[model samples]
Target: MTQKKDTILSREIGKLGGFGARLVAGLLPKNIFELTIETHSPPETALEKAFTILSTEGKVIEDRRIDPNKPAVCAIVGSGLGNLNPALVEVYVVSTKENITKLVIIGTAKEGLIKQYAGEKAARRIADLLTQVLP
Candidate 1:
């Protein structure tokens, strides 16, 4: 599987955040959060487990291997619509060693300047869910 192209909103947000972060430094707070965990399972198995875990939480929007030759690296993106401000969760799986896999789960949400906790809340929710089930 190949990485899916970013949605228009996502692309624009990336541009805005990238530029804003650099231009204003701390003005636009970070909207992305990442959590990493190591699993004893192989990459493929780990990815499957992660998919199942995420599916229960929300709709999985995209899933694909990063490279055909390196199937050990893959990603899954999901959307959680339970909140008024929806959040996107991206999970990346990489094989680091024999029988060892690393799972990087990132949660991103749009936030307002005055209220900047949405992103962190989304990230922490996904992190807790995955941590309780992944390992």
Candidate 2:
């Protein structure tokens, strides 16, 4: 994922790697969070657990599964905002031939300053719930 050079996040990521002079016309700022969880489970099992947790939460909105092969789901939740908030949390359970499975969770805030914070918080909640529920 790429960040806008003018934004604070882009400047920070830029320090790690120099920015490529790209136009900002179609660029959108996204606050992303990632986690890799080690589990001895299948993608379906992990996806089920995450779906249950998010669906049970009242804050969750637009909760839907993106894919089952990779077993990914996304939801927009009330991380201090209503349905209109762009704060999105996406969880993916990826598995290889081995028994190990990697659960990746990402939070995206497409707009607003406070929404960015909300996106982070929403991501944390999803990760925490998955950790507590999944084996």
Best by TM-score: 1
- Which residue runs of candidate 2 sit more than 4 Å off their true CA positions? 1-28, 58-69, 80-86, 111-116
Query: Which portions of model 1 miss their true places by more than 4 Å?
Result: 1-30, 65-82, 114-116
Report the lDDT of model 2 for residue 105.
Answer: 79
> Candidate 1 on 2-119: residue-level lDDT in tens?
4322342244344545655334432344466777788777677666766776677655666664444444222233333435444566667745687677877766655545565545
What lDDT is reached at residue 125 by model 1?
Answer: 69
Residue pairs that clash (backbone atoms under 3 angstroms), model 1: none
Task: Provide C-alpha RMSD values for all models, in order.
Answer: 6.6, 9.5
Q: Candidate 2 lDDT, tens digit per residue, 1-135?
A: 122313533333333345641223115466566776767766777777877877765234333445534456665554635543335566776654578778787776544445446557667878888888767
- Error (Å) of candidate 2 at residue 111 is 4.7
lDDT score of model 2? 0.58
